[model samples]
Target chain A: MDKKLEVRDGSVVLKVNPEFYPLDIIYSAAYVFLDKAYVLLDGDLKKEILVKLQPKQKQDLEKLGGEFLNELINYADYKHRAAQTKTIREYLLQRALFTNDPSIIPDDDEEVDYNEILNELEEDDEELDDPEGIAVPWEEKYGQKDEKKD
Target chain B: MKKKIKLVLNKNFYDKKAISQAIKDFEHIAKITILDDEFGIELLQKEPLEEPLKEEFSNYVLGLMKNENII
Candidate 1:
């Protein structure tokens, strides 16, 4: 496999293309390296993601690079599985919520009739013409002004 | 000696908040500029910044992206 990493200034820098790995995947992989190394992220977020791993303890840099690559692959796999199970997970969650919550089902087997409540409200036909326009009629105001000018 | 590095990031890859946070972290050491769309950022600092400094700044923004779920 072509190594995606390089050792510079005693720091292991891995350049992973954002197209293949994604920022979220890089974040997940970075979290795993936190305990072992002082990790830094660099590079253009659009094209690539750069991960710099400075070991907290003395260790083989080559081995560390290999380990980081493995961690990244593992996290990417996790992301794939999560996406694959999204629908089933959502369905299970919905089922669990409906089954556990008593509010979804009412007691006394009574069905609330919204139509009856709506009918009880006194109907005012005039309310339908509720004017949102200016109260004064335009013709009344303008016509009077024209008469005064005449 | 002073050095300036210009980086043009993908507009879709970053947001203002994340870029602002990254700039703030380096404000002391570097004069930074990030465009309104966050498609580019410039850094000017006395002496070249070690690779780790750039790496940390990137990670800092990445952490924010993870927290905010922008990425």
Candidate 2:
């Protein structure tokens, strides 16, 4: 019943102005509805983008139309956030890759002293530094300990 | 009888893949020639294509162009 959407037969058609709703946003929204409906888009690229939503099953046309509109808004918000965080996301990824990769470690960085590092570890370093912790030896951790050792 | 049908589609509004897909619907009976001109993109239909079918094909392409693929 919405002015922008029309219900016909068992499907819904939406005529969205490309100015308010961009093409990429439409695609992202349609991708979510793809499982429930067969989506088709068309329009004179100049002004509006026409979308035809054909349900793959029996359902209420109005509900689906509402969902599509909501999805468009949701996707648009996501796109805006993504654009805003692009630089921060890139920085985060770069930092993660740098810290986790040994090969890429900077040559100017200070050498890591194992004993000094161990001394600086928290008191629970037994659990932090070793695979099996202070309670168990290599063989015991490997399930080869004597049964009577308990 | 063979005839030529010309349909004007907006250049910025149409998708080539959808047009090709629509063309496939009538591939057995028609030959399609696409051209770009001042009035918009032109789809010249050859081989006895009916007016209604041309309209239907246009609508089909329109729907496809609107639904873009996104990740």
Candidate 3:
């Protein structure tokens, strides 16, 4: 098999095809390695991208190259799956928000007054029947007990 | 002794604004001159640093690009 990565001068170089890995995906992968290595990108964006990774500490260049390649695949798959589920994700979000609060959805036919709704809620709270005085606080119904001697 | 390093950043890969910001941030440490696609950096201090200046500068530019959402 032909070698895809080049190791020289304590650095690993990868010639990434732009078609297989988009520029954004490459950027995302490169960002993840910023702290671990010195990442330098140079090449034709339309054709091939040359990614150079110089590890901060002593390590195998081949392994570093392999990790970078894996990151590229990881970002590519994430982007692909994100694009595929975008519509569904948006739909689910809409459903969740609407279910949680139907008042958030705008209604063209009816004008809503927030203050009026709040007033109605207050009135409803006042109208609530508490035959057993269950709504009363314990402190309000009973006097505070005297502290026991230590 | 003053040291100088030349870095040629391709227009297709690098964002001009990010490079400008990186240069501005590192101006205290080095005198950076921009000529089209190339950046000429002249070190002001003579002391040996922990990391290579050229690599650090390039990494700074890359960081700026990512932080500014240019890449």
Candidate 4:
């Protein structure tokens, strides 16, 4: 049940199962929605950094956070929070470029009018404060202990 | 012939709920523990063990597996 996947720096990880794939998938979804370029992080401690996505994108990501929680039993509690934060960063980039309503726009459009959704997209002041993204400190602290190998 | 069955588990399984679930997953499993978090997850071996079975042991184990949806 508690099989460790990787350990590096200050963290030890176990890959039981990913309860919520969409929280992670939303990053790509937002990129599609916003018609923007983005990258996902896999090196070092494992992080996601979005080069661009607007405030509205941030809001949309948070709203989707609940869907991640509801969709899977594995995401019912604290686990959902961390995945949601990473998704939001990427979503922000999608929010930055625009000229018209994205809902009505076709996916083939070369550009998005982020200005139009600027008002529709809510800004999360807390996210701006934490660029690294939000995760409970306990997951870091408890996840670090090297399990006793016998 | 009697054989020993060993099961390795995660530390989180040390928690009551996780432990109960794993034990219920296998009928012939005799012991489960967290020896190595990295590579010991599939350590459980199913084999016959010499032990007196209580009248309701199978039912009790089955019930736990059913509750955890591991059945």
Candidate 5:
């Protein structure tokens, strides 16, 4: 399979090939680290904000074992996109810490807050304006309809 | 932090005398609750508190069980 995406920096990178493994596998690994590897993370980066998997987090992948990594993606397929994303975020974030990649790893005493207020606003507007486009129902405004309705 | 999620395997992963050599293997990283009467071995792991991660791990274990035809 060809390189599907590359999360790169000066020293390290994760070159993903979608053909070899599904997207969920990549995502689940990331999610695992974000939740379990907090102690391995820089203290400054730990507080004040949620940490996301950096682009270059391939180094720590070995420790999780080949079976675990394989299981991650396989599980992602069994689960759903949201779950896979969290797992991928964890796996990637943990790898970033283990590898000591300065570019991706936040510095000590750094304060970062990830807020998507604009995204939320845009989403809200989209939901209001394009009723059919959104997946979730707007129960308050539009009465719930049976999903199997003809 | 991960919690021990129990999974029972249809066959035990051990032999009586040889198994005694390893102490840590018996101790589950997650949690192995064995149902002696049932035909399976239990595998466990700590689950992350994060909802999505928890669900993924849950599915991962469930997938393993399903894939292996354990349950």
Candidate 6:
């Protein structure tokens, strides 16, 4: 393992390579230590990043630095896995949505005219089967009810 | 008697806006001057504080960076 930590008086300095650990990952890892330690960032962002951590309570500086390194690794792994599974995740989401509502995925080369379909249904209404006259209008079925029934 | 301390922060890693906000927040405790990237802070009170002013100031700026989503 490369020596990334340098223990100083009551503090530890970490030298991070931006190529391996991105700037956002470093920031995320550093944010975790803010409550436990006084964190300061320096050095060239493009080339190298220097993180200085001084614990609020009495603690081993080397141990704190090691924890910070682990956090960086954790975030880096998370970012890598997210990127790798992005396509599959999108595919799963589309599959789920299509399953829930098939109409969500439009048919290509087929244009649907809802008004035409409605007109066709109206023209075929007379041929529909209604044995008990269930489809009759309410007023036609019962003749208008006595208006002033007491 | 007044105590003075200096902190040099890198522009690439630290946001100037966050640092400015920190300076404003700690203005009551210390007299701060910004020269380039260096902050010259002179303590106004002689008594020891609950936390060291310099470290607390640095922590406050980092907190602001996180709060402002700069980091």
Q: What are the chain A TM-scores for all the models, listed individually?
A: 0.64, 0.64, 0.67, 0.17, 0.23, 0.63
Q: Assess each prediction's global lDDT (C-alpha) against the native.
A: 0.70, 0.66, 0.80, 0.36, 0.38, 0.80
| Model 5 ranges with Cα > 4 A deviation | A1-14, A37-61, A65-68, A76-150, B1-71
Candidates 3 and 4 compared by lDDT, better number: 3
Note the clash tally of each candidate.
1, 6, 0, 14, 34, 0
Which is better, 5 or 6, measured by DockQ? 6
Q: Residue A148 of model 5: what lDDT?
A: 36
> Candidate 6 local accuracy as lDDT?
0.80
Regions of candidate 6 where Cα sits further than 4 Å from its true position: A85-150, B37-47
Determine which window of 10 residues in candidate 3 chain A has minimal summed lDDT.
Answer: A141-150
Predicted structure with the largest TM-score when compared to the true one: 3
Q: Please give, for residues B6-71, the per-residue lDDT of candidate 1 as tens digits.
A: 766555545677778778877888788874464566777755655445445555676677677775
DockQ of predicted candidate 1: 0.14
TM-score of each: 0.52, 0.51, 0.73, 0.19, 0.19, 0.67
Give the per-residue lDDT digits (tens) of candidate 3, residues B40-60. Answer: 444443455688777787888
Q: For residues B1-71, could you state the per-residue lDDT of candidate 6 as single tens digits?
A: 57777777767777788888888888777776667744433435444578888788878887889889887
> Fnat per model, in the order given?
0.25, 0.07, 0.68, 0.00, 0.00, 0.82
What's the true lDDT of residue A41 in model 3?
A: 87
Q: Please identify model 3 stretches exceeding 4 Å from their true place.
A: A99-150, B38-47
**Per-residue alpha-carbon lDDT of candidate 1 for residues A28-79, written as tens digits (9 for 90 to 100):** 8876776678676667878767777888678888789889888888988999
> Candidate 3 vs candidate 5: which has greater DockQ?
3
Interface RMSD value for candidate 4, one decimal? 18.8
**lDDT value for candidate 3?**
0.80
TM-score of 1: 0.52
**lDDT for predicted candidate 5 compared with the true structure:** 0.38
